[model samples]
Target: MSDTTHAPRAILADDERLMREQLRSRIAEVWPELQIVAEAKNGLEAVELTREHKPDLVFLDIRMPGLTGVEAARQIAQLPEDDEWAVPEIVFITAYDQYAVEAFEQGACDYVLKPAERDRLLVTVERIKKRLAQRSGEAEPDGPSNGTLQQLLHSLSARVNPGGAPKYLQWIQASVGQTIQMIPVEDVLFFISDEKYTRVQTPTVEALIRKPIKELVDELDPALFWQIHRSTLVNVKSINGISRDFRGRQLVGVKGLDEKLEVSRSYTHLFKGM
Candidate 1:
């Protein structure tokens, strides 16, 4: 048995409220000692929270509003380490599919299918426990690396479709008070959701749109913009730096903005190196 002094921590990421709750309940029953430090509604948040909490394990839903689970996992694996915490063990929460399960096994990554069955969850929990025990007192070298994650993602993408690419948004028609502003996507600093309307921030103009952040993500370029929270997507070029607040929350500094943008716990992975 491993030393009992250190209890494990974990984060769960899923867009569905009910799914998160269900997984939490199941994990609690199987591994009562494992603490759920945070929960995320999308892949971006999943990556960020993993950076902030440095949890020993994470459960990522395959599909989410912003980044997919595979995308988030790739970033998480690549996060520069300050030795504050080890890279977490990843457990993909996927809808039942034989091909997906096979891919996960080939990558040597663990997974739990959706609507988690107690027996299945028990198996995953026991495997994690065994892995943890085996690594006790050893250096953190067991978790998947960026290269491994990237290979897995590439393989999966190839299986989905070859030579297909998504078309990203180039411009946004947002309302500014009484006027309709045509905003180039490159000029946008960030998009923050406020219930029904999403606020678009640029250097010179702030605009509002009826589209929600969830919908806007499909139209946005994943490489140019990154979601740091369920409600926030920021342009990669617009970010100057990242800093932590008094509460230990990561905040993003824009090039010209006086006020810093809050990076929610679930989206901290984007600036883990910083």
Candidate 2:
């Protein structure tokens, strides 16, 4: 659907060569004109291939040796932009448990179960084709937001745990100079990002950890650590009240904390009046 001058190109990335071959052969059958440009055996290779080829589509496998499929997609999504380039459509090739596959219901991206099914793939192909047409300037393009994709990737990563349920963190081990401290999650008042580090503040003391808020969002109980801003998450129990700044911005006041966090417009609904 992209520029009728030629077939849209694609890259296939999976650890197993046999699985890649099988998927390639199957896709050829379903979408004959679509060109298979390259194949990669790992997540790192996938990103490299995508960068070199700039293909219109990329099929990624979730689990790889060093980097994960989600991580690869994250990089691909952030690849340098150009007036002539459009980010490739991404499809995940997952050999996930049945429970884990349910995470795809949100339709964040197209996916195919292992040992791909022709009938099911037919539907996926049709939908993808329509989106490609939209991107080709046939109509307005519609896709999931970056935040939605972040949440989807988070849900997919949690499946790495047994039984497809995430085990939330109860304690945080942070290093302080020569001492390592065990900080209970209940004692933390808030977390804010500081470039590569995350500052963890408790009622009595503060500490730093390398874990970013994006990573912590899944590891912590969401009901307790509500995200009031992009770079900040506050413990629900530690929140004293919500107030508005003179500029009409929502400010979250934390118990025992002097500085109030400015709530981004995207998250003001979290403090909506009942």
Candidate 3:
């Protein structure tokens, strides 16, 4: 007889009941060996369930009411570094694909886009199984848990508006003469639209790129960049501050750059605290 003693325990979390149900059905159909022990309607409930059951895996939503999914994951990661509780593997479920890169950077086991598909879920489950096996013999991973959570929060904050914050750009690539240059994300100072293309201004020079201002807004790091106008996205670090002009219009000044970009009335709220 085979020993059936080590199947992984799992939990599912999502704000939508229909989504959770669909995910549960898909998991049952595709990966029957993984056992789901609990389900939650929000991040808070998910955290509570994690604490209560100490499951081996958690399917977390990126956005949730009360406590955001990232916040809940942070709390769970803070659980005492003890042998009694095994660290759960987190798999993010999000509506937007812009966060996929950041999610991977933060060490998420995998991510599933909304309106979940069977093939993707299967792949995610496979990844989870691999991670769980690798961690089975170890204590927590070597890196700081706080750092991981912080990176994830920063990435998500750029994607969503919690309290009238600016939305981040989805993706950015620059054109320099004949060669298309992919801007090092950290070096970007701001983005400005000019006719048919958007111009990316870094600390050193500016380059033109073919991306819509609106779509790029979803990809930028929120804490680092702000959309002060429909045509511009200014880096928070580069911004000296905001000042009002003669016509009572807001204009933002960058530290090294001489250009003064306009802040539209529609997006003025993003500059409130700064």
The estimated TM-scores of all candidates read 0.55, 0.54, 0.53
lDDT by residue for model 3 over 113-171, one digit each (tens)? 76678898888877776666556643344433546665676656545656755433333
Residue 192 local lDDT, model 2? 94
Candidate 1 local lDDT, 1-274, one digit each (tens): 2242489888999876657777898898988999999999888999989888787788887656577676777778777665345567778887635537765576446888766788999988877776665456544546455467668866654543336666355567577886555578999999999887889999999888777898878779899999999999999999998888899888889999987889887787778767
lDDT of 2 by residue, 128-238 (tens): 787777777876877666567667776666555447555566666565554446578989999999787788899887788777889788778898999888899999998
Which has the greatest TM-score? 1
Query: Each candidate's root-mean-square deviation in Å?
Result: 16.2, 16.4, 12.3
The models' CA-based lDDT, in order, is 0.77, 0.77, 0.72
Estimate candidate 2's RMSD in Å: 16.4
Q: Output the TM-score of candidate 3.
A: 0.53
Clashes of each: 6, 0, 11
Candidate 3 residue 189 Cα shift, in angstroms, is 38
Q: How well does model 2 score by local distance difference test?
A: 0.77
Candidate 1 deviant stretches above 4 angstroms? 1-5, 138-146, 157-274
